[model samples]
Target: MGKKKHEPPPPTGGLDQNGLEKRLCNCICLCQLVSILSGVALLYLSVIVVSPSKQTLDAEFESTPVVCTTLENMRNSTNCSVLSCGEWCISKGGSTCAIIHAKVRREGSAVSFRDCDPVRATFCSAQEYNQTQQFICSEGEDKTGQCDALDRFMDCKPIKNKADDIKTEMTSLCRNITAIRDCRGTKPDGTQEKEIHVCTRYTCNALNGIYECSTGNCKKLENPTCVDRCSNLDMGNMAVVTPDLFHWGRCRSAFSNGTRIWTDQQKPLSMYCTRIRNVSATEMEAEDCLNGTLMDAPSFRQITNYKQMLGVLERNEEPLFEDQSFLPSEKTVEIFNRTKVMINVLGCVNTLRKECTTWLAHKGRDGSEGMHPAVYPCFITPHATNYVITDYDRQATVSQLVMASAVPSCLLLFSCFCLCLCGKTVGVNEFGLFFCKPCHKQDGDGGKEPAKLRAP
Candidate 1:
């Protein structure tokens, strides 16, 4: 018999070549369709995942009350009075009432009593009194026995109301001294002294050639020369005076160096006794004093304004909602007209310093617009578009879009590879691609061989 033709064992699974090819083509078509559909679905899902929706939200804002309280209550108050006074005293080259008040408060009983407190005649001496009497009698128009008698009488009669008498006598004496002088013939510094009479009031100290009594009473001198032995004029402490005072105010320095410098040349030194309006428990509002005019505490309305930017929306105004289908025509107008909104004042400084201000408002869920107590740096206007622009578009970044597209692209490439191998002599059945090498029986030759490919 003719050797049997070695036709490739009947196409696996009892399927004819035509039948197997048909089944493989059908599988490739199904896989290609699945890949295309999956890719399209993935692309659609990616767009939905990254695209940001645009909507106009009706934003309503309110503000908390600006409760006035001391810095001690605010938990930031400091004893800067010492530095404040020392700087002022140094600036004018003299001491002031504010300085004396500060000294007395800080140093307690250690501070020498001026004639302001004559009950404590700690520095008064008979020798000083005799010299004062002699100088007064000599300077008067009547240098006769009458002036000496008057001086004697004043010295003896001052016990009844010592404080009253001292104030009266000191005021008279200070007014008479056209120029400052050393009470003793020679200067206290042991130098030859000329014709100036030392004046004593609350305390004994040499006065400047030109001096004026500060407003309250003669108890404190406005512009007296820095001659008191007890005056602790420390340059180090005074050097930090401006920063300390600014710190007391809690002001953010507009200077490039982030500090406020105090110099004689700078107008309106930072140590001036300025007032803040709309002061709250945590915040202090600074105000400018014009022509030395003292400003009164801010009114409630002004305080409210300082804390918030209030506005009234007119009826029929453009609706905050981009899609108003859910809102009634009349309701929209009513809500718009009734709703009130306010933005917080960024800086605590007065209205004159607008450059430091921010347009951002503190927004809260409830109507009560309370905020945590913290200082915020000024916002960059150019970068802060979300704050000012009510209606703006937001979109996903380029990187997100790329990632969304890449995942589906990889899936499509994998599916295409499977499609290309569909009709080969490999396992491709209704259950899908299966490896047959593990399940196949080994031939007598000891070589592992694949089982016949199954046809769907």
Candidate 2:
């Protein structure tokens, strides 16, 4: 009988096979569920990615003129418009083809402009010509009798009556206002760009197909909106339709030597947006936007902080902290500093927002409530303030974020909820509590002993 005995019958072969099958089924179902959830999240992200809607278009004008002395042979061009002033500096409509404020090449054979230098660089490219540019006559050439200095240095005119200070309080205000506007961008586009403006808004009215760059024909949108507020590319902030400092291309000096005029706007490693080691004062060379940003800062141009000044200006007319002269008084400095702080935090949710949107038929609930839309921003047009931040508004990045972040989060939560209802939590091994059976898990007798195995 012992010789005839075979190996002990396998214990419950059917039960082992059934358990394995159940685990495999659970894994497959979980995978399918995760895949479906990911798809849904992606679809949602796509829906929000849309072309920016048309924003309000209000005209901005700074009629007060600055009394700048004209350069010899430098004359205003018909094409001197905000859309074309940056380009008009180099055009050849006789010697007068250059912008009114453009310098003349005294040494060159042609009646050519002196490469815009300090004058046209900002009008042309802000990153290339930041805030260091200024309109001053050469110390030797600015004399009362030199190169129509009478007209060139209108701001330097003296009064015979009284103490020879400001002509009048009102005149002083006009001059100061003009000086402030000039410190930033001048004659920026709503009216005419080629024409040098003393107190013009340093902006490009950020509507698509509206503003164009002087170099590379780059439209304003190439620079994305960084501030949650306005988008003007003047010298104050890096926002769109706004711009600012010691960066190259804005200007090489208070005067021009010709070679520093034209620069590429689609900034590359070799692009001349900064001074090369601060050498070649005539070349507008900068290799990085961040470097340029630091160099042009008003509060601390010498320090290189990674953060940029974005949406800091509601009115491009504000004085810059970098130039103490622009901030004539302590009160002014305090006011501007407070303004920058507030706008940086609240965006264009204040006066600038109202002024920017009042003309644009912003008929939202806020508009009806006698206020600009606070829930959404007013200056949040398509034009962004920075190039790096533009990617977030892109469709591809949004989709990836949803898939990468949402799926794992959902799975973790699902697993935790699942554990809360479990009856059997197998553990005390290598992988503790890896799997478990729910309290209501189905059994042939529903937790009761099977009739066949029950004690009589």
Candidate 3:
């Protein structure tokens, strides 16, 4: 053979070259898409970490609230599929009526299913009534409770039945009759008069300090009790706050005279009892309470001012008022349970240091008019935070949030590594993940290995 010619292997086979390039390009394109998506995810996560407190929503919303039994029963009674706005009036006829309803969950809220409760229905403002249904929002005081004959008190009055016994009377402030619980009355002669004891909100042990409800079963306990400011000239009992007499009520530092610190420059908050109950006749006590049995408030006789009262009321514990945090089963709205109440994540309450006051917490805070909702008849009921988030429950939500984002975070990291063989970058745009932006050119020397690839 005259110099056998080998023609440079025929430029590597066109089919093989084309197929390999196509496969590589497809892979690179997929990686680019994945990288872009991963980068967005990372950025989103970063933004959340540095963003406003997640508690911001919590500030205005009760995260996961349950319906009070009285209201829940109302919900069960509704036979209609589509609902209407409600006008719940505890005592109607005029502005004097105590409208009992809450904001319902909006048509599209995270927990809109809660709107199933009747208290929220028929209670929304005119602006956002359900569009599909014929909306009806009454303009003035609601009269729905009229048929029910709710005992709505326009003002508190003295008990005329007691026959000149001015010490006790009928008042919107309280309902059930109460005996002067535990205290020694002081006469003008400066001598002790009668020593008596009555139902107190807390069961206490003197040495150990105050603890739980004095009433073994707060549900059955129906007497309304509280610690009001006293005056030296006043004839009210000079009794120390005993275990049974735990402090409960809205002792807001601003509106209230905390620890009486206003008079003197003290670092703490305090209040003064200017007007309080004057003693009468009735109940008496029979106990030494030596073994922490009769625990008194810290510095009872010398109670000057509340040390710090504002933040304390906001705690998730059962509300301080007998009228607050009571289960629907607790039939009675204690004398102190006012028409106005604080609706919060804790529950519908007569007193709340935080948030504004409103009636008819028929809806959630995010509902047409939002609030921590509750419902009750003016009868006896169990006292507790049936609707408030327990400490254990409040704690459980945070971990779920962290665990929920774990999968996405790992997926993002995994995507970064996979793209490495082609091309990828991390920490781009502070949190951006960039993938291979590759371009291929037809080789002048023909396809040898492949286009020059970049490391991820």
Which of 1 and 2 is the better model by TM-score? 1
Candidate 2 lDDT tens digits, 1-456? 133333322222222334644574466457557656755654543332211110111111112211111211112435522211121112323222322221111111111112233321222221211222222211122221111111111122221222123233211101111111222122334333342222211111111211222221212222221221112323411211112222322431221223322122311110112112232433322221111112224442322221223212222234322342321222222211110001111112212233323312221122121111212111112233110000012234345455655665677566545544332432122222233333223233445533333223
118-232 per-residue lDDT for model 1 (tens digits): 1100111112222332223223232131122221012111112223323333322222221112122223565543332322333322222333222211222222333211112
lDDT of 3 at 384: 28
Off by over 4 Å in 2: 1-279, 286-396, 403-410, 413-421, 424-456
> What C-alpha lDDT, on a 0 to 100 scale, does residue 367 get in candidate 1?
16
Worst 10 residues of 1 by lDDT: 100-109
Which 10-residue window of candidate 2 scores lowest in summed lDDT? Answer: 102-111
Candidate 1: segments with Cα more than 4 A from true spot: 1-9, 13-41, 50-254, 257-396, 424-456
lDDT of 2 at 411: 71
